[model samples]
Target: MGTAPATAFDTEALRRGIEGRDAAALLSLYTDDAEIRVVDRNTQPSHPKIVHGRDQVGEMLNDIYSRDMTHHLDRCVVQGDHVAFTESCEYKDGVRVLASSMVSLRGGKIARQILIQAWDE
Candidate 1:
């Protein structure tokens, strides 16, 4: 019997990146042409904030991780070329944020992601 092949996505690295607030590490998981669509109170489903390319995504990640907040990778599940994860964050002022993401992988790197987030108002 043949053994199952290992998946290319690194969940441990993802955990470290998210929990550690390491934007660069997280950015490394994406392909050069990767894209991210974000939906939140400001950017509703009808008009999501779209970030294209690794550079743009990096900028967003940097902005997010730079905030005075704590982040936790709550859950992650991977299947074939797809991954889904939940993240929770708390700001210094006690505002809590929750985010869920679904990602599509291509050749071991993230090709596209859809992120939905909500926070205490």
Candidate 2:
């Protein structure tokens, strides 16, 4: 067959995708069956709960943009097909929070994502 493209996820590319708020680019990073879990800082297990799915992930991002005007990635680490990062942002309501996210890539597309708040106060 032909040589395969790199299977690794590029942190910088993903950063640009997120920072640029490019939904198509962001979606392109994810696999068809990608899983995404998000736990809001103020949310608990008993509450509405974590979000899951590729489309859901996109929806969440859209919802976030509906509120927050901007979001910035502070740092990221890429290992094999996985990437983890920390992001800081202020919501449209002016609430600031730090979020830690872990992503798994397969065939150069994101296969899963686990995100949680990374703050004590």
Candidate 3:
């Protein structure tokens, strides 16, 4: 029997990227052609906000990490080429946001991701 190969995804790096608010570090985990679909109050399940390509994803990450907020990786699960995680954030004003994400990995990099999020209004 052959053993499975080790994945390149680094959960520790993910935690550091999110907690440290390092957009570039997070971006490094994604493939060049990665795609991300986000669903929230404004963008509902029927119509998700889609971001394609590393450049676009990078722009989004930069915008998010630039905000005056604190982020924490609540939970993370990895199974083969798939990963799921929950993240919580709090703004300076006390507003809170929570997000859950499922990601598909290709060659150890994120190829696609679906994220569902909610925030205090």
Candidate 4:
């Protein structure tokens, strides 16, 4: 098969996908059964928003795309099949979010991901 995303550009692809609101490119990095857990100001540390499979992920991404927001990737690190990054997103409603995410990759696709955020409430 192929290798690990052709030297880390895949992470950048994810960054661009989010900033550009391109759900297809963003979801392309995930495996079919990939799961994402998000814990933020709305979501509690005790109970995170969990998404299973590509369909759910796509739906969630679409919801995010529907929002009038701007996304920026601040920093990223890829090491030993794990990737981590920090992102900031600002919405037209004056909500600003800073998220830190960690992901596990399998066969060049995201197998699991967790995102924790701090935002204006």
User: Is candidate 2 or 4 superior in lDDT?
Assistant: 4
lDDT (Cα atoms) of all candidates against the true structure = 0.95, 0.72, 0.96, 0.86
Among all windows of 10 consecutive residues in model 1, the one with the lowest summed lDDT is 3-12
lDDT of 2 by residue, 68-101 (tens): 4567889988877778888887756666778888
Tell how far residue 99 is off in model 2, in angstroms. 0.8
Q: Rank the candidates by lDDT, best first.
A: 3, 1, 4, 2
TM-score of candidate 4 relative to the true fold? 0.87
How much RMSD separates candidate 4 from the native structure?
A: 3.1
Q: Which stretches of candidate 2 lie above 4 Å from their native place? A: 1-6, 45-52, 118-121
Sort by TM-score, best first: what order? 3, 1, 4, 2
lDDT at 110 for candidate 3?
Answer: 92
Residues 19-107, candidate 1: write the lDDT tens digits.
99999999999999999999999999999999999789999999999999999999999998999999999999999999999999987
TM-score of 3: 0.95
Clashes of 3: 0
Q: After superposition, how far is residue 95 of candidate 1 from its true place, in Å?
A: 0.3
Best by lDDT: 3
Give per-residue CA lDDT, model 3, range 1-121, as digits (tens): 9977866689999999999999999999999999999999999989999999999999999999999999999999999899999999999999999999999999888999999999999
TM match of model 2 to true structure: 0.75
